[model samples]
Target: MADIAAASHMSLATVDRVLNRRKGVSSRTIERVLKAAVELGYLNPEAHEQLAAPRPPNIVFLLPMGTNPYLRLLGEKVRAVADAHSRDQPPIRCFFIDSFDAKALAAGIRQHARWADGIAFMGIDHPLVREAIEEVGASGTRLVTIVSDLPHPARETYIGLDNQVAGRTAAYLLGRFCGGRKGSVALVAGSRTYRAHSERETGFLSLIEELQPGIEVIGMREGHDDRNENYQHALALIEQHPDLVGIYNVGGSSDGIARALTQKQKSGDIVFIGHGLTHDTRRLLIEGTMDAVINSDPDQVISATLAHFNGVAQASTRNHHLQHLKIELILRENIPLQYV
Candidate 1:
């Protein structure tokens, strides 16, 4: 405690408050203590063991099942992490729910309450889903929203990017890359039902309007994160807007947009900004089909969620604020050599 306090430039009492998850301490102070403790080996296995005996909390990851590579990758990552810690940690079960269906997601959440100690999912922003989560929480099941969030206090934690900021970042990159070209830009998303997509669209549109008033947002379309669907949407947008200068894909299935742009002979001519750093996006970035990729680490998100439910003391001290997760901007040269 003394070493952590000294390293964090805080008193021992403040460190104690943060470590013990006591109220009345500022989040900033808690972050400092977490950083110091993690650096000083206080958040290691020994520390975890000292905090409490490993209690395997039964956690379920309700993920989207579809052709979207990003969602698939997220599910794979969750499974991988769960497998790695299966013997020592909680039994993490992944339930693949239908994509963009609020009623189905709510049903899944409610049905799993009997078997799960906690539930985490990429929820659609709907009243039914919100009420389901609230009911599950009331049932003593910890609720976590992954990759997107519901209204405040609906879930215990949200594990994903600040989609609004991600959208604004995409807009900034797309707008600037357009070189002040006077033309309309298209926006593609999995579905506005995903809070993340809607937030990104809102942020992107707001910034484009504020910074580049001349540039018109052609329209926002839901592609359901399906390659064929996104391809059709992008093709329609291209055909509708002969003066299209750029495109921002706030959700999955960017490969469809790339294909559409290539077919339309606008691959390099039109600036493309997208989300995720999957195999397709990586190739697109390298081949110049994609200009920039706004990436959020699925592994980190899973790790954080697991730690949160595991009663890990360090998780309490670490930052859990919305938008605190790192939003990496990847270009061709700066792209990681490995895609997984």
Candidate 2:
């Protein structure tokens, strides 16, 4: 019973309810327990023979390979959760491909469609990607877009926050923090290939124009979420616009921005806002290098993906349905205690 519980990643009480066929236990939970029991050879041979062999669900998570700690955390959590539930054979696999390469991502989808029961990925909005998603759907494989969404209508679900709202939130925070100061601002993104980043820039620029007329947006640059690239962009912004009062990073590698600010002696002078919360950002926030961080929980996103595979989160959150994740605004004083 303990082994079965462990394999199912469920509490002993929950396992008991499932094995005993209790009323409160959901069918999904019961199936998971029974499958674990059978895989562990805990079920009686005669009883096991009466039921068909358990065919574990196959789930593949395709994530971007980059220096972004947030994506790293996501991969770690997915692996941990997958390990917890795995018995003789694992059901989940995470594949990392080149960042911002639409062809590579689309190829991954097409390749995984052959074997994966479900595929979830941080999608890029592109014609080739949409074609691949549609092809995968037609092949009867479930597909979900995570973090960043694709423009395709074939994706089974999208699991992430409303990025436009997050952008607007950043604009509101930066505007309020600026206190009606007239100055130029700059925006940096990993890549506009990501719909989330583009959406964020749109909402941010729109709100800034409406609420803070004095603040001029210098322009946006593609940093590709690289430390050196973003650092260079920061330097260029400082050099071109000496009066640049603020910067909003729509993607990762915010530490690069911090370093640039420190070098220019404008760490606190320039109002800086970025996305994601890692150790680097935590320290920056405490040191006043960053004024705000708009974040989405990677753990929650992974959990939602897993729940979808388990048929636990499918009723309400289905195909093309947006499970708008919680968007958090972190300040130095209100930094979350849990780093990971």
Cα TM-score per model: 0.81, 0.83
lDDT of 1 by residue, 1-340 (tens): 9999999999999888677654345556666787789889889756644333434567899988888888888888888876777355678889898888889999999998877878888878888898898887776677778788875464767878988899999889987898888899989989888889999999998799877888988789889999999999889988989999999998898999999999989889989999988999999998999999999877778888887877634333433345347998999999987673
Error of 2 at 214 (Å): 0.7
In each prediction, how many residue pairs overlap at the backbone (N, C-alpha, C within less than 3 A)?
A: 0, 0
Model 1 score (lDDT)? 0.83
lDDT of 2 by residue, 14-57 (tens): 98866654324566777788889888988866655433334445
Model 2 regions lying over 4 Å from their true place? 1-54, 88-90, 312-318
lDDT of 2 at 108: 97
In model 2, the clashing pairs are none
For model 2, the local distance difference test gives 0.85
